[model samples]
Target: MTGANKQRVDVAIVGGGMAGASLALMLAHFCPHLSVALLEQRALPDADASVRLPSFDTRATAIAAGSLQLFSELGLWNQLRDYCAPIERIQVSDRGRPCGMSMRAAQQPRASFAGMLGAVVENAALGPVLHRALAQTQTQVLAPARVNRVRMVADGAQLDWSAGAGCPDTQLQAGLLVVADGADSPLCRGLGIVTERIEYRQRALVTTLGVQRDHRGTAYERFTDAGPMALLPLPRRDGSHRMALVWTCSEEDAAILRELPEHEFIARLQKRFGWRAGRIERAGRVSDYPLSLSLAREQWRRNLVLLGNCAHFLHPVAGQGFNLTLRDCYGLARALAGADLAQNSTVGLELLEAYGRDRRLDQQLTIGFSDRIPPLFASPGLFARGLRQAGLLALALTPPLRAGFVGQAAGFGL
Candidate 1:
């Protein structure tokens, strides 16, 4: 490639999944004057077509009320609401125990949106909506473009990428580089960003289920000896009631469950989950992912920042991972909204540092919340069981405790 082929932008984002796409949109909205480019290894879906990326698989994400407000700001709520099932209530329980707690949106109006605590949307549906919105923005979209190398430059960072094998590489220079590639990021590894990881030794089995009756806009969190399970309401399709399920269990148990016949699997699920959501009539394909708490040692450098799963990968038990990332994206976009990146090199560094400091408390609390819940409820010992019961009792009986829990879960005041 000749020097004339090299391109420069104010910011370049790697990875066009939910995190990258969202940060791109936010930058366009908040920092319209800044030139931005988004690069993705996978080809982006057409405006009217379905998305087929790793992030847009059969899994579903629970968008908290705060996140819904952020989407509304981006003018995506109208398109998203059509495909989402509102979560009007949340029920938390412990298996084989009679004590449990439930939270209703009516009880905490501040933690809800249009009387909804949150909403669940399948990632497949979410991806196209996001990409379609991106098509209208000024940010450059470079899909099927693989980044082979990245290095720090005097100005910022430079990325060498190609369309495919034997294709000439193109160099992209930017004032700031946002890395949103998924966990175990190659770019981060090349940048020498160390990650702290804690494997839970459990896998989350995910699938869509056909339920016998309506879920009534309720999401259930059930904790058992095996692990934690979540049943989130989903929009009805073809007149069939459906819900998304995330069941966490040991590797051995997951292996058995994956191989079980449909009837046997449903039977075991029904027995374990109880009659809360009524009978499970059917299930779609099941997929499993290993659970872990992964945090990057450095989220920001002089000319770089980490976003999404690359920055922090939290357990999904509290449904907080994506929401936290959304918050981080918003914070970073706001910090860089009107900065003069070209005229002042130190401006970017100062803003990135401030963003990191502002996000520290929220990230710590949310990560700790997601990490502690599974083991606390999964414990079989007498003391742990007693603590679980007491916790449930406090949440059920105390309004302050309930409100605090609802606010945190709903992504409010942070």
Candidate 2:
């Protein structure tokens, strides 16, 4: 082991996936004077678009318009514009049921979900753009390296990383450290931050499919006894129009769904999904994951703050995880600009406190929103089902309730 380098930076961020990378770029581009060091375990990918990404595993993200505006400000929107699809409207309902509610851009809209509220982008495709944006900025990226230990003290935060073989260990001391390592963050646990996780007994089978008819830029959310299924708009890739499908079902049933033949799987999906768009065809392979909500005991602690999944992992029914974390980055950046990172280093106690305070309302609301929707539509009991059905009918006919729903989707009126 080498001696401690004792290097220092204004902000040291661990976990360079979407959240950490975006934060580094935001800070460097918007607050250049602040020295930012981003630690990403994966090797920095080549920016050449001609390079082929792995097939049968293209994950799509529904990006809100506010997130797009952030990307646009970083000059990334134009780079990503060609590969993405806009969601001009979103249809929320219980799959195949005649009575339901819908929301469209023209009915009530905002700039955050793209022109409507959000745009869906392939995750693999977007990663490179964020990397490119970082490469062009002043941020110092320590790729293929990760923190082995995080020591939070009264004075400041100490980060120790074991570099790749043939490289060396690193010790970075910063006033503030952001943890975007993900929901199961080792750093958070190491810091004695207990996270509460609630298993929904559901799993989501995620994949893309070719629609029999045009999506017309509308995203669909339908709930069945199994769980809530969403078909989000996707750009035409590999010579076919695509939409990302997130199908939630009981853990055991999800396993059954995963083993079914492609044709059989699509047939069952069509039965519940109905033929709203026409004949549905599988566009890619499916990937399944457990669904849960994980919330940290606190968002900030002694010069360290958790962002993205590390802070809160939502059910994805509302498509709020990434967007909510981006807003955290937005809020923290503003807090730093308005206050002092230097003085707050020891605890950043004041800044962190404020960030925590401003973030709580949004966090609780989004988490609850995503958590409640699935159960509301999935319950089968006579009373529970009736209540949900009645609510849907009232929401469909009532203007105020419909407008409120739209406002919430637009990232406001919460």
Where's the lowest-lDDT run of ten residues in candidate 1?
A: 50-59
lDDT of 1 by residue, 246-285 (tens): 9999998999998888889899999999999999999877
lDDT of 2 by residue, 1-414 (tens): 345576877788999999998888778766776888899877888655543444346888888766777788778888888768888877777754667877676666543444566788888888888888788887888888868888875666888886777566788888788999987988888888899999998898999888777788888888887788889988876677678889888888888888889899999888878776568977468889999989898888767888889889999896888988887897888777777445324445777888788978877777888888788788778787878778888888997888776665555554
Q: For model 1, what is the error of residue 335's alpha carbon versus the real structure, in angstroms, after optimal superposition?
A: 0.8
Residue-level lDDT for 71 in candidate 1: 95
Q: What residue runs in model 2 are displaced by over 4 Å at the alpha carbon? A: 1-4, 48-56, 111-114, 342-347
Q: Alpha carbon lDDT of residue 207, candidate 2?
A: 90
Candidate 1 achieves a global lDDT of 0.90
**lDDT of model 1 at residue 203?**
94
TM-score of each prediction: 0.96, 0.93
Candidate of highest lDDT:
1
What lDDT does model 2 reach? 0.79
